[model samples]
Target: MKRALLLLIFAMPASLSLAACAAAQQTQAPSLAKRPIEGRFDVAPPAIVIPPPGPLPSDLAGRLARWEADAASGQQAFAAERDATAALVAAAAGAPVASERWVVAQQAISRLTAARAPLSGALADIDRLYIERTVDEAVDGLPDIYALRDRIAEMESAQDAILQALSAALPGQ
Candidate 1:
């Protein structure tokens, strides 16, 4: 009776361990053949398209035109002033600061800076319009506004470069 009792206790645990090991082996084994995926894996997502913007409103269009014209005129005036200043700066390159030529050169530089006002004003107006359009959710006119702004900005940069070069050319700069 004692021997049978001890054998039952030890055999019970061994039988349970064997059962667990067999279940693990079955789950870990690879399948003999690969199955096809349930759905189309190569399918592409739909493309997104955005339509081009329409014309700007009449009022905004007129304002942009006026600003563009103003920038053009300003660019012309700046070019003239830049040339004059460049010549003056060249003449005063080695002159003393208190000499007449140096004084004239300084005055020319001042006028050159003043000549950029119209272009600056146009850029400022365009910036205001852009802000207003964005705030009002008027997106249709943004492209034109941006185009004008970019053009004016380039002109302004060129003027600035000229100004820098002229200033640097002056004596005791």
Candidate 2:
């Protein structure tokens, strides 16, 4: 037992030391592949710039009791719409969503397109200064909805191009 204990106690430290050295050497080696982007669920609350205390729309009064709450809800809704569109990009060749998801996304986009029409002036340093009512008003320059309209135009153009190419490839062409 004495001999065994002497070997075990002394040899154990040497064995452990070798294992530690091996681990350190392994860690020093360069990785063969790029690391993936980390999935972060830590969503920071969005900072909202609320429109001023203009005359509240009669219909909106009930939905927007407190200015902060109304702003938060609007922001949250917009965020959901934005994320859905991002997913639609990965949902295959077509829109990434389907059924109710597609419908809701389309509706949100439509509502957002309308919402931006009256945002004529360049964005103010502080969004709270704008009259919330005016956001729905039709301003100049393609009516503040150029972005959404442009997207539609691009989609139409792409479809037309595809059709044209197909026609050219046909046997009768």
TM-score of each prediction: 0.70, 0.21
**Per-residue lDDT for 115-172 in model 2, tens only?**
3322211122113223443475523322222433344344334434533443333222
Shift in Å, residue 148, candidate 2:
27
Query: What is each predicted model's overall lDDT from 0 to 1?
Result: 0.89, 0.43
Query: Candidate 1's error at 20, in angstroms?
Result: 9.8
Residue 41 displacement in candidate 1 (angstroms): 12
Q: Which ranges of candidate 2 are over 4 A from the true structure?
A: 1-65, 90-108, 111-173
Q: What's the lDDT of the predicted structure labeled candidate 2? A: 0.43
Estimate the TM-score for candidate 2: 0.21
Tens digits of lDDT, candidate 1, 1-173: 99999999999999999999999987867776745774557678888887776678788888998999999989988888887788999999999987999999999999989988899999999999999888987888789889989999999998888888898889878
Where is the poorest 10-residue window by lDDT in model 2? 117-126
Error of 2 at 152 (Å): 28
